[model samples]
Target: MTVPPADNPARFLGRADAYAAARPGYPAALGAWLEEAGLLSGGVADIGAGTGLFTALLLRAGARVAAVEPNPEMRAHLEASLDGAVRAGQLSVHAGTSEATGLPGGSAGLITAAQAAHWFDPARTVPEFRRVLRPGGRVLLVWNDWRAAQTPFNRAYGEVVRAHTGDDPLRVRVLEDELPQHLPGGFERHTFTHDHPLTREGLRALATSVSYLPNQGDPAYPAMARGLDAAFDAHERGGQVALAYQTQAFLGCLD
Candidate 1:
C-alpha cells in the first residue's frame, strides 16, 4: 500500500481501526492529578483527539469535552465509540486541527493534545489554543514515550521497527522537542510508568497501527511479523507481553 504524504492530514484514514484497538490510554493516575490540579474543570477541548482515546478519559473524569479531529475515518470511530456521551451532552466531536480548532473563543477552560503535539505547528496551534481557551486556561500535552526507558523488549522491538523503516517522511513517532517552551509561564512536567499487555496478535496490531511501520499488507510485513513475534516470544509471560511506556505530560498555560 502506498503511504500517504507526510503533509496529508488524512494520512491516518485507513489505520483508525488498528490504532483504536492497539493504542494505549493515558494513565488513570494522570487523570486524577489533572483533577487535583483543577485542570479538568470548566470543560475541555481535546484537540487532535484521534479515535477518542484521551477523550474517553476526559469524559470519565466528568469533564464536558469537545473532541476535535481532522480525519473523517478516525473521527468516525471516535464518534461511534462515544455516541452515548454525545447524546447525554457529555461530549461533542468536531472536525478540526490544532491550528484551526473551529471552536468558539473562550469556549474551553483546557485544551489537550494527546500523542499529537509533534504534528502541530506550535505558532498557529498556540494561538488557536489561546483563542478557544478561557482566561488563564491550560493546555495539556501528553505522549506515551515508548523510548523513555531502555528495556530488553523495547530494544528488540525497536530493532524490528528500524529494520524495515523506509524513508517514510510521516514517521514522526516521537516529539523531539518539548511544548512547554512555546507555552511560557504556568508550566509543570510529570511522568508516570505505564504498560500495555498484549497478546501476539495485539502486538502485531500495535505495530501495524504505526503508519511509518510496515502494515499487514506491506511487503515487509512478513519479516516485521516474524521479528515482532520473536520479540514477543522472548518476552511473553502468562500468554501476554507487557509493553512499557512513560506517560509524559506537560501542563501549561499559553502566554
Candidate 2:
C-alpha cells in the first residue's frame, strides 16, 4: 500500500457522516488492556480522534480525554457525538493534528492514535507525542482491520477495494510494518477479534467510509457499491451480515 500525502484533509471532506456511522469502535478489551498496563493512570490524549469513537471509550474508562483532530467536519462530528462528555468536563475537543496537538508538555500519561496514525508524519508526530507524554508514558496505536480471509464475503470485499483503490496505505495492516521505524524502542502488540453486524445499507456505508475508496461521484463508485451489495447478499443472514475484524493494539513508549 502506498502512503498518501500527509495533511490531505480533503480526503475526508464531506464524508464525516459515513465515517462516524460505519466505523467500528475499539473493543472493550482495549480498555482492559490499558488498565492492566497502567496507561490510564492519568489524562489521555486521543490524536486524530474522528467522531469521538475511541474518545468515548477513553471517557467511559474514567479518563479525562483530550480529542485532538484537525479536520473541521470530522471534529464537529466528534464534538457533537461527545457533547454530554464535554458538558460534564470529561472530554475536550481540540483543533489539532498529531504533529501539533496543542497539549501542554508532559501532561498526558498516555497518547493514542486509533485508526489515524497513517495520516501522521512520524518524524514530527512521534517527537511531539513524546513531548506531551509524561515520563514512562505510553503511546498506543490501534486499528480494527478487516479479516478479509475469514469468509467469502470478506475476501470478495477485499478484492473490490484493491481493484478500485489499487494500494491503500490507509489499510490498518500497513501500520504494523511502518510503526517500528517510527518507534524504534519497540512496542507490545495485542490482537482481539471483533464483529460488527451490518445491514446492506450499513455495509455500503462502511465500504464508502474508507478514505482511499472511490466516492459517490467517481466513475468506479457504482461498481464498488455493486460489489458491496453482492457481498452483503451472499453473507447477510436475518437482514444483517457479520463483518469480522482483527482489532490490533501496539503499545510502546519513547526512549
Candidate 3:
C-alpha cells in the first residue's frame, strides 16, 4: 500500500451521508471488549466520531458517549442524525480532534479512535491521550479491513480501488507495525475479528464513500463503480455477499 502525499483529513466531511450509509459499523465483539476493559469508568469519549457511527454503538452498549469530531460537515450530520440519542441524553456531539482535544485533563476514562487513527499524528496525540486519561485509562485504536483474499467478490472489489485510487488508507494493515512503534511507553495491545454481509448496493455505496473518489463526479469514480459492479455481478448470491473483515483493536493503557 503506497501512502499518497496528500491531505485527506477533510475528505470524508464532504460525503457525510454516503459515509454513513456505506461504512460498516463496529462488531459486537469489539464492543464487548471495551465493556470488559472497564475504561468506560468516566464514560467513553468517541474521539474522531465521524458521523457518529461508532458513537451509536457505544450508546447502545449503555456507555455515556461524548463524540468529538473536527469537521463541521461531519459534526453537523452527526448532530442531525443522532437527535434521538441526544434528546435521550445518551450521546453528546462535540467539535474536536486527536491533537488539541477540547476535553479537560483526566476527564476521560476511555478514548477510542475508529477508522480514524491513521489520520492522526501519533507523536503529539499519544501524549495528549495520556494527558486526558485518568491513570490507567485506555486508548483504543480500531479499524475494519475488507478481506480481499477471503472472497472472490472482495478480491475483485479490492482490484477496483487499486486500479483507480491513488492512496487509500483502507487498502492495507499497518497498525501492528506502524502504531506500536509510533507510540511507545505504557500500553497493551488486543485484536478482535468479525465479518458482515453487504448487498450489491451496499458495496457500491461503500466504494463511493471512499476519500479518494470525486465529491460528485470524476472519470476515475465511474471506473471504480464499474469495477464494483462487475465484482457484484460475479459474486452476488441470493442478493447479498459476505464481506469478511479482520477487525483490529489496539488497546493501550496509560501509566
Candidate 4:
C-alpha cells in the first residue's frame, strides 16, 4: 500500500465549520458494538478527533474521553462542540497528532480513530497507540464510506469528486487492508449502514468539506459547485437527498 504525504492537517485548516456541519456522524450502533465486545468500561482516547464527532459518541457511551486533534482550528471546533462535556469533566481536548498523542502510558483502555487514520504514518502511530493503551486494550478504526452504487445521486457526486480531485494522492483506505499489516496484532472487522439526509445546501457543504477538493476561491471550484448542483437537481426528493454510507469498524489489540 502507498503512504500519502502527511499534509492533511494543513488541508483542513480553516474548514472546521464546514467539516462539523457536513460530515456524517457515526451510528449509535458503534457504541453498542463496543459495549457488546466488553471494551466500553474505561478511558477512551479518540485520536485525530476532528470537531468531536466520534468523541461525542464515545462520551455518550459513558466513557471518559481524551480527544487528541492536531489542527488548531479543528481542535477549537471540537472544544466548542463538546463544551458541556468538558465542563463536567467527561472529556478533555488535547493538541496532538496520531503519531505523538502526548498521553500517558497505559492511560487508555480503548483507542479510536474515526475517519482519521488514513492520514497517519502507521510506523509511528501504531507504536504510539500501543504506548498509550493498557494491557488488553483495543483500538477501533471507523469510516463512513459513501456507497456510490446505492443511488444515482451518489454515483454522480462521486464522479464530480473524481473529476476534480483525481490527481490528489490522498485517499481513504480500507482499514481491514492496512491495519493488520501495520498494527502490532491483527484485527477484526464489522460493518453497518448509515444514511444522512442532505438538502442542496447540505450537498454543497459536503463537497466543500472534502479536503482534497478545490475550495471556494480555487480556479476549479466553480465547476465543482456546478457539478454538485446538477447532481442535486436531478435526484433531490422533497428538497432533500439521501446519502448512504457503509460504516466500517475494525478492532484489534496491540502487542
TM-score of each: 0.91, 0.93, 0.88, 0.94
Q: State model 1's lDDT.
A: 0.82
Q: How many pairs of residues in model 3 come into backbone collision? A: 0
The predicted structure with the larger TM-score, 2 or 3, is: 2
- lDDT for 38 in candidate 4 is 70
Against the true structure, what is every candidate's RMSD?
A: 3.1, 1.8, 2.7, 1.9
Backbone clash numbers for all candidates listed: 0, 0, 0, 0
lDDT of each model, Cα atoms only? Answer: 0.82, 0.81, 0.73, 0.83
Report residue 84 deviation for candidate 2 (angstroms): 0.9
Model 4: worst 10 consecutive residues (lDDT sum): 167-176
Q: Pick the candidate with the highest TM-score.
A: 4
Lowest summed lDDT over 10 consecutive residues: which window, candidate 2? Answer: 1-10
Better of 2 and 3 by lDDT: 2
Q: Runs in model 3 with CA error above 4 Å?
A: 1-8, 166-174
Screening candidate 4 with a backbone cut-off below 3 angstroms (N, C-alpha, C), the clashing residue pairs are: none
Encode model 3's per-residue lDDT on 92-171: one tens digit a residue.
Answer: 88887787778888877888888877777776777888888877677777778875336676677777777876545534
Better of 1 and 3 by TM-score: 1
The parts of candidate 4 lying over 4 Å away from their true place are 1-6, 167-170
Q: What value does the lDDT take at residue 59 in candidate 4?
A: 82
**True lDDT of residue 60, candidate 3:** 69
Global lDDT of model 3: 0.73
Q: Who wins the lDDT comparison? A: 4
For candidate 3, the TM-score is 0.88
Question: Residue 149 deviation, candidate 1, in Å?
Answer: 2.3
